[model samples]
Target: MATFHHYPFCPQSRFIRLVLGEMGIAPATVEEKPWERSQSLLMINPAGHLPIFVEEQGLAVPGAAVIAEYLDETRGLGLDGRRLLPDHPADRVEVRRLMEWFLVKFFEEVSAYLVTEKIYKRFMKAELGGGPPDMAAIRAGRSNVRYHLQYIGFLIGKRNWLAGPDLTYADLAAAAHLSCVDYLGDVPWEEDETAKAWYARVKSRPSFRALLTDRVPGMAPAAHYEDLDF
Candidate 1:
């Protein structure tokens, strides 16, 4: 039994939750306000990041990479119906590459705006800037998302999964980060049919169900959120 310490709206935290649900682990939830630098959260992970997992091993795991790898190697294969990280070495590298693209690159360009404006503000009021969310930044992010989605569409057209032949960590990372954007109806799904189709496949999985249910304060998910076709 693991205890997943999370911030509800953090995409990475939700990514771990989706993995737990897929693994059928039903981890104990410990929602922490990560930006507040709480002694408890920091005690678990001195880095003070959300989704710090208190593992079955009696140690705390920090970051999505660490948690995902731990579960995929030790637990996901046995417990999850869908293997997140494939075994083929070459395929695995592609997965890592795509995961880095979305989790690091996509996040720097997009998630930073929405997550900070919408979710973090509610939890860590102490850390907020005096100015409001920059609509210009938000606009640029939305535009950038179109390009990423197009790239994903290309990948989907060429490969069965985001990373070569298997649905690996890359797929989950993309969906996880995108879910936050989707929650705010920020995704322009109709513009790219191929991207929408690929997203539909990822979001349709049983592991993704819990993430679809998460509701942020004052922000409701779009009507199509629960719709598998969308």
Candidate 2:
């Protein structure tokens, strides 16, 4: 069986996992702490990243975006469900556009800061200069998240899914990041009915059930993190 190395709170890892789930491919999972800089991780991914996908024959695919596309090409096409990527060239562009928006823009502006401060710092060794969560960064992430939430509402309002008619990797990417932030109790869902409704729909998917069960060591998920009705 293929093997997947990842950490629970990492959005990139979560994105890859969701994509794998959509592909109906279950790789043997191995939890990894990249902050620890394990020799095994460095060997698998010279970039020293989390969410490395190693095939049965020992082909290691690193990074979430790369792994997502790799799976779509190798497994997604033959899967017994909706295709993760659109067939048309224009639609593919839109899917990649939104995927980049959530993975890069939203991540840089919000999720990255929050995860680095809130989750990574807590488990990170003191020798690595890890410390208490930075209140300033956390506040900034919280403020930035609202704008992204509005953007999500804007996108979903015009389409059935974030990208287009069918659910694409774009939806998975957005949900992956938002779900991590939501796990931290940082999402203000009550403020945006449209985005919240869209998220509720995503949350109800069978593929998302495993993510809802994720539990960080010392931190419990937000009250509504796993609640389908929320």
Candidate 3:
């Protein structure tokens, strides 16, 4: 079996996890703290990041994007579910665009702020930059999430999925980030019913079960977190 080094509440890491789950791959996971920057983790990925996917044969894939692509290329097809990458060139481009938008734009503007300020700061050791949470950063991230949810609604209205007719990596990436924020109960789903409905659909997928059931030690998920109807 492959080994995955990642942390709970990490958006990028969640993306890779969902991809692996969707592909029916069960990997042994090692939770790592990027802030601690362990020497062993650095040896595998100089970037000192979470989510280093290592194969039993010693093939190591660092970074969520690389791991996702690797899984897609190697075990993307002939599985129980639909392929995460689209077959058509244009559709693939759209999926890539949406994937980058969520992984980068959404994270930079919103998810990262909340994850860092709320989760990391609360649990991480003070020497490693963890302490009291930053309310201002959390506020900014909460405000920014509305726009991103609207965008998801817009995309879902046009296509059956985020990228096209099939549920691609774009949907998984978006859900991964949203799932992190949602755990903190930051998303204003009630403000946008369409987006809430769309999320409800994605949340019911078999691949999302693990994410919904995930718990972060002292912290608890929202009342509606594991509620498929919510």
Say which candidate scores most in TM-score. 2
- What TM-score against the true fold does each predicted structure earn? 0.91, 0.97, 0.96
Candidate ranking (lDDT, best to worst)? 2, 3, 1
Q: Candidate 2: give the clashing pairs.
A: none
The TM-score between candidate 3 and the true structure equals 0.96
Better of 1 and 2 by lDDT: 2
State the lDDT of candidate 1 residue by residue for 1-230, as single tens digits: 77889977788887777777666788888877766778977788888888887877788889887888888777866253657777778767788889889878988888767777666665555545524666787887788888888889999999888887766778888888888888878899888888888889889988898788888777678778788876
**Local distance difference test, candidate 2:** 0.89
Report the lDDT tens digits of candidate 3 across residue range 1-230.
88999987899999988888778888999988766788999999998877899999989999987887788788886255667887788988998899999989999999999999988787779887899888889889999999999998888788888888887889889999999999999998988777788788878888888888889788999898899998
Task: Give one digit per residue, the lDDT tens place, for model 2 in 111-178.
Answer: 99898999999988888958898899999999999999999999888999999988899999999999
Per-prediction backbone clash count: 0, 0, 0
Distance from true location, Cα of 220 in model 1, Å: 1.5
lDDT at 157, model 3: 80
Consecutive 10-residue window with the lowest summed lDDT within model 2: 74-83
